[model samples]
Target: MTRRVFLSIMTAAGVSLLAAMLLILGMLQSAYTQRYRQQLRDEAAYAAAGLETGGTAFLAALPAGSGRITLIGADGTVLYDSIGTQDMENHSGRQEVQQALASGTGESSRYSATMGERTYNYALRLEDGRVLRVSAADFTLPEVLRSLAKPLLLIAVIVVLLSLFLALKLTRSIVRPINQLDPEHPDKAEIYPELSPLLDRLSSQSGQIDEQIRELRRKQQEFAAITENMQEGFLILDRDTNLLSYNTSALRLLGADDAVLGQSVLGLNSGSSFRDAVERSIAGEHYQRTMHHDGRYYQLIANPVHQEDGIIGAVLIILDVTEKDQRENQRREFTANVSHELKTPLTSISGFAEIIMSGLARPEDITHFATNIYAEAQRLITLVGDIIKLSQMDENSIPVEKEPVDLREIADFACERLSQAAAKKHITMAVHGSRETVSGVHQILEEMVLNLCDNAIKYNVEGGRVDITVSRDPRGAVFLSVADTGIGIPQSDRERVFERFYRVDKSHSKEIGGTGLGLSIVKHGAAYHGATLSLESELDKGTVITMTF
Candidate 1:
């Protein structure tokens, strides 16, 4: 800033000095040229008078001076020459001499080739048919300019030096007050009186700018806070596909660190498809994709941020849709299983009815066919009922009534309801525990206990023991555990043991004569009663399902 100010001052001074020098030189040249011409005229008139009065004796007697006196005959012959170069050139034929012959007096200026100098000439026609011309070597405009060069150069040097000195002083003087001004507290700074208005405006504008910056920062912080707390991953990218900002969720979802910021998305991971989608979004295309990565499912949505010119960046939102995807898969499987389950029973009933209608079976075999048809119909009814219950549980549409019920009594009732099945399976089942009270809907609790006991009997080994224990633990919660010496679930299958229509032994499932929804119902019912269900099972050892109320 200081250098700029100094240079500006020096430039102005130099230009002004140049203009003044040109003007003075022009005026001086004109005045000096005119004065020299006038002198030449006066000398010529005086000499002409002398020659007329004393003839050639006056010219011969005169001392030699800087002026040249030339006498030319009317017939273009040089009569006498004082400067001595008139030997070859006739003075009567000169422009001034010819003019003088025609009009009695003439003056002109020209350069002499022999003398190599310029001269001013004044010719006056004499009464004796001759011309008396006075000539003087005079400085031409070029010579005059040459004479002034030294002084002008000295003046220019002085001007530049003085301009430099003054420019420094002036620049510092003007800038000091402005530099000393405290922009943050402009009211307290001493400044020029003329700048008071500007200072006031500066102070006002400073406050406004500060406020706007603070507001912008505060808004940015608020946005950061909101995004950082979001469950879905949120990210912003620049037009170059570099990461501008990303939330904590985004970092976790992408398995990336904060170092990924300001880097291209491709550098963060091997998800080329994700990077491609981001590039497409930056090109003003909206993109969406569902990807399974790192044991979870995510839905990516990219939207371009467009301005008047074009897309400037993009906003990417990663949705953790793991649960949704799982639900969708479960629904598909349920549909397939429902079709298969219904088909099996319907086919049996259809085959038996066709056999009866065709009369292909003997009369004795008719009873057996009818019985099998009735059994198949009952199994179909059970499957339908289980499906309806599962749907209701999924919809959370069950009505609830909170009432205190004894866990021991529910276990007893469940065992009695499945006593025949237990007997048929030859499984020993008994309830042995202190009575514990729990507050929930009686129907839900009963259903939960019944399912657990039925599962214990259905999957138990022949003559295996089924124990129902209803008691309270140290936590003061009612605990009901149904432990069976059954074909235990495998470690891998334990996680999915409660899913609808999932049977561990599919080939023997029909022989077992049980719907695969027993444990699924138990899970839902226990959840409805606000009970925690835990399963401890081992292959070929035993399984225990405990419900803590």
Candidate 2:
């Protein structure tokens, strides 16, 4: 804006100066030309005085611009002409001729209807009584104007070029110091004393602004660092919907892995709750809401970022509390499940004890009661062990070292171990194919494979077949499959099956004499090795569990 103002001022000043110079030059030329023409007219009049004797030889003595001399007799008949015999019949009506007849000398400046220019015409009547007339241009202005064309054009061009240079230099000088303030060397281009006060005011203002900016930057970095370090996501934007900034945490929380700055925000991070919060913040408001993404919950906040001018951008902070929330929920659910499990056994034990104390049970009955109590105690022990294992996995303190291992051997061993369990159900456990040694933690891999095979066998119908296949597929990655002809998992529960202590069939899990942490452990184990585990099953149909390494 300042540059534009400077350019406009320079242009106006330059044009005014050029116009004044040209006007002065034109007046000077006009005055000089008028004086020169008058001198020529006087010399012509003197020659006309010598031509009164009817001597045609007088034409030789005429001045320059007294081009064609004509002497008319007293009766208006042409007596002599320098060019040739007179073609016109008479010349008495000519202004110069009439003026000459009036006195010894007469002058007139008028447009010649015949010549098409204002000419200086003069004439005199000599003592011998013949009329002499002379004429010349009033100022010879045509020749002067033709001669001035080159120099005038040159001067105009020079003025325009000079104005352009001034516009460029002056505009830069004016606009530069605004956005780029020089604290170190403030006296660089001291413009003028009139502007000196403004500069001083600006200098003081800039000092204050610098301190403010330092504080702002410090706070911005603090917020930025927090956002970068957080596991949740964050974003900043303006009312124009242009992206201002985002942190690593915000990107992850928003699931925008490839977000770009200065672009529109709608392309990524288009989560509806997050978008609405940003819009509200742009109006200088703050809001917080819980939004769900990827089966998790996040608390998103939109805060207005302000400067000295006003609110500039909206800062968004996303915090992923899904893990913590889910943990609390799990804790509550576990307390309930444990209380329920314990209540049943405690009731039975109490009832049996009461029966014994009341003599309602004989010695054999007492032995049976003791056996039932011991079984229930073992169930509680298994359940407690499962809880500890689940907690250990949750801590994730142990890291795994992955390497190629013989999966065929591990699978064979696990099958043999669980073969008895399968046999009790009259189910067939079979190995479909063998695989090359794939890379993974030996212990985790073994546990995961064993758990899948065990689940497959345990869930199978009587006389059903359980097939385990291990091989390197076309993807060049090694995978293991455990399929079962069992009552398949329901679609709704399939997603929850990998959650800790989650069981599709609680009664069945209890009857099978196993902990519900098997699938959760397998999921964690797969995650530790960066392998993939997927399950596909339908109710009343078979199920397939695949692990790719």
Candidate 3:
């Protein structure tokens, strides 16, 4: 701005100065020409007077430096020429001579091409009927200016320098106040009246901008709070699939680091389904897919972000559906297992009853068939009861209030109830450790302990021992452990033992005459009591299951 203003002022000054110089020069040229012409007339008249008195001798007496002089006869023949050049042109056709002949005196000027000068001629009609002429030659206007070129150039340089100095001062004065104005407080600046309106506008705009910035920051904070607290992974991407914004859950779910920001979404997970979902969303289509990442299933829901101009980007939501998927699979497996387990008992009962009803067996066979039927019916009832208990736990519909219960009492009760089974298996059962009280439903704890003891006796070797320990660990946590000398679980089947209907020895599960939900019940009851369950087992050695509350 300053440079433009300075240049403008300099240009105006230069133009004005140039015009003034040209005007003055033109006026001086006109005035000088007029004055020079008058002198020529005076010289011509004086020469004519001298010629009238002194005749040709007067011309001879004139100084050589005098201007050109000519005497012409009335017949228009050159009588005397001061320069004395031979064969001089006749003056008959000369305008000044013709005019002097007609009148008393005449003046004219012409350009001499050879000399490049303007020649002024003044003619006087002598009383002797002859013409006396005096002529003077001077450089033309162009020649005069050329001769004064150095001085004019010096003057122009001086003017330009002065103009530049003044222009600089003016530009500084004009621009300084503007530069001094505070953008944050434009209204407080003391400046030109013409700039007051501009300052007011600046103040207004600044206020508006500040308010807008604050609003944006507030909204950004709100967005951050919402996203940071989200459990599901959330991501925002540009049209090019570059990550723009993301939540912590997204980083964890995708196994990505913070460095993934501003990088392509594929950098986080380039799996086919993940890439497909993102690409489809970027193409303005909504897409969803189940993507398996890090051995966990994730539901990727990609939505195109739309505005008036069309789809500009995309939003990706990744939900950790691994638990849901596992539950679904469990439900299916449990349904099939329950059907097979129930059908087996009911089929055995039905077959035995049919044999008695059909009279296929005699009176001796009838009692035996009845005993088998009763046993199968009992097994069915137990299986149904276990299923109901598990269902109740699953739905959290157990209608029992919690109370402080002694772990030793529960362990002793379990040992008593399963004593007959232990006797039949020739397995020794014992409870050790002091009383450890925990807050729990009494019935649930008893059932959990019963299941643990029952499994220990049922799966033990003859003359093997089952030890139930009820005590407090060093951490003051109530610990209950059921260790047995039984056919230990294989390494492969150890982790699955706590799942419903999962058995370490599936081949002997039917002959074992027990529902497969024993450990599962223990697991659920432990979870309900806020306890941690751990297992240690070695094939052909023994197994130990511990619960800490």
Candidate 4:
């Protein structure tokens, strides 16, 4: 800014000085030329008067350095030349001589290129028929300038030096106030009045910029808070796949440390599929893939961040899909198990009926075959009913209406219904404890108790006992506990006992004549009623399953 101002001042000064010099030189040249012409006229008139008074001898008497003098005859012939010898050209064609012959006097000027001068001529018509002319040659404008060149250059140098000094001083004066102005408080600075408007605008813009910066910071903090607390892993990467931002969940899911930040995303997981997905997203394509990290499944979704120019970066979202995948796998397994379970009883019933219809059975075997067919059909009905109940519970389509159901009554009813089965196994079943009423669907509660008691009877040893207890814990929560002296479950298999179609003893499951879905039904029913189920068991001892609501 200082240099610019200095240059501007110098330029203006240069132009003004040049203009002044030209104007002065032009005026001086004009005045000098006019005076030279007038002197020529006066010389001619004086010489003419002397020639008329003292004859031709008067020209010889004229002083030296008076200028050139020529006398012409009336016949257009140069008769006398004051400064030269004989032969001379006629002056008839000369403008001044011709005009003087026609009128009383004439004046003209002509430049001589060869002599580098301009001649001013004045011709006077004397009383005689002859004409007298006086001419003086002086340097032309170009010659005049050449003669004054040295001094003019010296003067220009002085003027330029002076101008440079003034320009520097003026530039500093102009720029000093601006430089001293406080950017933070432009309005408070003492500055040039001419710059007041600029200062005011700067102050306003500074405030606006401060406000904008604060707003940007606030939004950044808000965004950080939201992403940091998110359950899903979130990551932001630049076009080059460098990690720009990431949440803690992202680090955990990717199994990476803080060093991964600012590094390539490949540092977290260098798998080809992960790299390919990131590359595709940076190329403006949305991509997704399932990645296995640390034995957990993650759904990795990469979406391009776009601007008017094109894709600038990418956002990667990693969702934990371990549970979801497990559920899907379970559903497929359950479908297959249902098909197999339903088919077995159906095939048995079909075969038994076919034998009876074809009369392959003798009269003595008819009752036995018919009875087996009825039992298989009844088993099929029970399997189908359990499947339907499970399906309803899984879909959350169970009746929402609830009533106060006594746990003791449910236990007693289950024992009564399963008494014949318990007697067949030589198992004694009893219900104890006070009536504990829990708010739940009565049908679901009844099914839960019935399944528990039935499972105890089916899995029990000969002459085993089943105890159903309904009571409250210190927390004042209603609880129902079913303990059975049965072939106790192993610790490892106990966790999976509630899974559909899961069985501890798959070999004797057929001999037991019980669907493996009883515990699963009880689990689903307890979950629907917002109750927590716990199991305590030891091998060769007994299994105790409790539901607390």
Candidate 5:
């Protein structure tokens, strides 16, 4: 700024000096030209007087370099010439001579081809009816200015030096107080009066800036607090792909540190999909991708930030949706499993009925085929009912009418209901323990106990015993546990026992005559009652599922 101001001052001085010099030169040339012309007129009048008194002799008596003198006859013949050359042209057609002959005096200036210089001519009419003309080769404006070049150059150099010195001095004088001004209090500084308005504006702007900075800092802190604690990872990037903002969640998920800030985002994780998404977003396109990082799933979304010119930057939002994605996948698999399960029984029933209708079966086999068809139809009905129950539980669509439910009553009722099935399997079923009461939905509690007991008997060893225990522990918690000597769940399948349609023994599932939804139903019911369900099992030994309320 200082240098620019200095140069501007110097340039203005130079232009002013040049303009003044040109003006002075022009006026001097004009004045000198006027005086020179008048001098020529006076010299011509004096020679004309001399000529009238001394004739041709008086003309010869003039000084040597007095300039060319011509005396012309009344008939337009040059009779006397100061240079004494007879080769002179007739003066009758000359502008000054014609004017002198008509009006006694005339003057003009033109270049003389003979003298090879520009001349100012003055002609006076003599009393003898002849013209006396005096001409001198004088300097033209261009020639006069050329002759003054050395002096003018010296003057310009002096002016330039002076201008340079003043430019530096004045520049310092103008800028010193400004440089000394305290930015914190511009208005109170000692400065020129002409700069008061600027100082006042600066002071007002400084206050506003401080206020805005405080507000910005507050907002930034608030934003950091909110984003840093969020479960979802968040990130912001500049147009150059540098990390602008991020949170703790993002750093943990990306396996980065605070040092990664202001570094290229591509350096943090150079996955091809992430890079592609960033590129697309920077080009003004919205992009998203699902990435697997650190054994967890992340949904990365990139959205372009736009302005009037084009895309300026982008925003990247990373959401840790591992649980949500798992649930969605489970839902899809469940749907598929349901379809396959329902289709199997329906296909069997349809085939049997078609065989009967077409008379393809023998008469002796008709009853057996009819019984098989009926059993398959019943299996279909049971599968449909279980699906509806699971769906309702998932949607929480069943309204609960809560009450204190007696676990002993629910257990006894479940045992009695499964007695025939237990007897068919040669398994002994008994309810052993005092009554335990829990706050729950009655229907759901009964269903939970029945499913647990029924599963125990269905998957039990032939002649194995199924026991139901209901009691309160020392912690004042009511719990119901069903233990069975059955084909126990494998270690790998134990955790998945409560998941719908997840059967440990898929090959023998049909022979087991179970829908595989009983334990899943028990789990949902127990959860709805704020109960904790646990499983202890060993292959070929037994399994115990306990629900503590």
Candidate 6:
């Protein structure tokens, strides 16, 4: 700031000085040129009057020293030459002389080879028909100008040097006061009023700053210790690739085992969920995600951070959620299983009561009752089997084991299992696909497919078409899609279709012996295999249940 102020002052002063100098030079040159021209004209007018008063004898030189003098006759002939001998031609053609003859006064400029410059000429024609012309060659004004040049140049140099010296002194003086100010109390700064003060606050502040720096260093060490001792991982980073700071817990959870200060978070872990979390946070998303590593699950909460300046960084707090997450997952599965267990029995009891109310007597009545009981029992067994399978998935991290089960064969078997039930409902079922070799627990996947096919047959209208399409999606993800042209589920119930104990038509589902846990089991199975479950349907139209694994 001081340098800038000084430079500005110097620039203004220099510009004013330069403009004044030019004005002075211009005025002086004008005054001198005018005086020189007037003097020469006066001399020519006086010399001409003398010639008019005396004749040829008056032109004869009585003067000791003067400029060139020439006299011409009335008929354009040179009468006399005082300065030098030269060819006498027509005086009427001479510019100055011709002008004097034409207008009674004349002036001209001519190249003087002797002076190597242009010289001024003046003339006056007398009443006696004689023309008198005078001219001077030397430029005395320029020599005076040359003398002023040296002085002006010297003044300019002195100004620049003095300005530089003053700028340095002022810069240093201002810097001392600035250095004295404490950053913490900068709003109320103190500066020395005197050129030299007893306090010398800059020196004092420097010492105090040194002490404060040591204190800050100690505080930083304590902060680091606190963060290290904290069980929850803490990570802070800017919007840039540079990671700011991380605690030991963060390093333990993530691959950044050591300090990642000033390092790129991207380079530390390539295939990590942390990278995704960071990207989302940088995009201004505040979210939490669970990541599992080495038999432990970490809940990472990515929150955006800001300072006085605005959004500059993000802080990610990581907490171990392995135990709680496992418990919650177990609870969800258990609840589903319990619901499934209760549903099948309830359906059986309701079906039995309905059959009892109907008045078919003896063997026919007994056969109908026995069939209904068997159907309920089979549904219960299927529900229990699904519950056991889902429980096994939560008890371990490794999948329930994979085998090359031709999905074609499984689909065939599922169809066979559900074929009898579909015939009872008078609903048609079919299986269609290409390659059917996939890796998954056969019993679980079989149940999932069978449940979907079973639901299609059960909910389907009498004689309604049940089309099972087994295929792979665009990403080569294998899918089992069971589409039915039946009284489809409503849009509002679509989201809860896979939820435990959730049914589209409550009364009708009981009548058809629905476990109400089939879709829930399907959902859990798909989740364990990292698969996606979805359904598209509209009321009174149709339904498509797809499971992609």
TM-score of 2: 0.50
Question: Is candidate 3 or 4 superior in TM-score?
Answer: 3
Compared with the true structure, the alpha-carbon lDDT of candidate 3 equals: 0.87
lDDT of 1: 0.85
Clashes of each: 0, 4, 0, 0, 0, 0
Point to the candidate with the largest lDDT: 3
Extract clashing residue pairs from model 2: 232-249, 233-249, 233-250, 234-250
lDDT of 2 by residue, 101-127 (tens): 776666677886545677776666766
- Which portions of model 6 show Cα errors greater than 4 Å? 1-382, 396-400
| Clash count (model 6, backbone only) | 0
Clashing pairs in 3: none
TM, every model: 0.70, 0.50, 0.86, 0.67, 0.60, 0.39
User: Candidate 5 at 309: error in angstroms?
Assistant: 2.7
lDDT of each candidate versus the true structure = 0.85, 0.75, 0.87, 0.86, 0.86, 0.76
Residue-by-residue lDDT tens digits, candidate 5, 7-30: 786688778877887788788888
Q: How well does model 2 score by local distance difference test?
A: 0.75
Relative to the true structure, candidate 1 reaches a TM of: 0.70
Best by the TM-score measure? 3
Query: Per-candidate RMSD vs. true structure?
Result: 6.2, 14.5, 3.5, 6.8, 9.5, 22.1
Can you write out model 6's per-residue Cα lDDT over 200-287, one digit (the tens) per residue? Answer: 5555676799799999999999989999999898888888857888787777766565774887777655646778788888777897
Instruction: Give the TM-score comparing model 3 with the true structure, all chains together.
Output: 0.86
lDDT of 1 by residue, 9-71 (tens): 678878998788778778887898788788888877878888888887788777876487888
lDDT of 3 by residue, 433-527 (tens): 99999999999889998888888887789889999999887889989999999988888888788999988778888788688999999999888
lDDT of 6: 0.76
TM-score of 6: 0.39
Which stretch of 10 consecutive residues in model 3 shows the poorest summed lDDT? Answer: 111-120
Q: Which stretches of candidate 2 lie over 4 Å from their true place?
A: 1-286, 292-298, 306-313, 319-331, 346-360, 398-406, 435-446, 473-476, 506-513
Off by over 4 Å in 1: 1-159, 180-188, 257-259, 279-286, 303-306, 309-311, 347-377, 423-426, 430-437, 471-478
Clashes of 2: 4
Q: What residue runs in model 5 are displaced by over 4 Å at the alpha carbon?
A: 1-207, 255-259, 283-285, 307-311, 355-371, 432-434, 473-477
Lowest summed lDDT window (length 10), candidate 2: 46-55
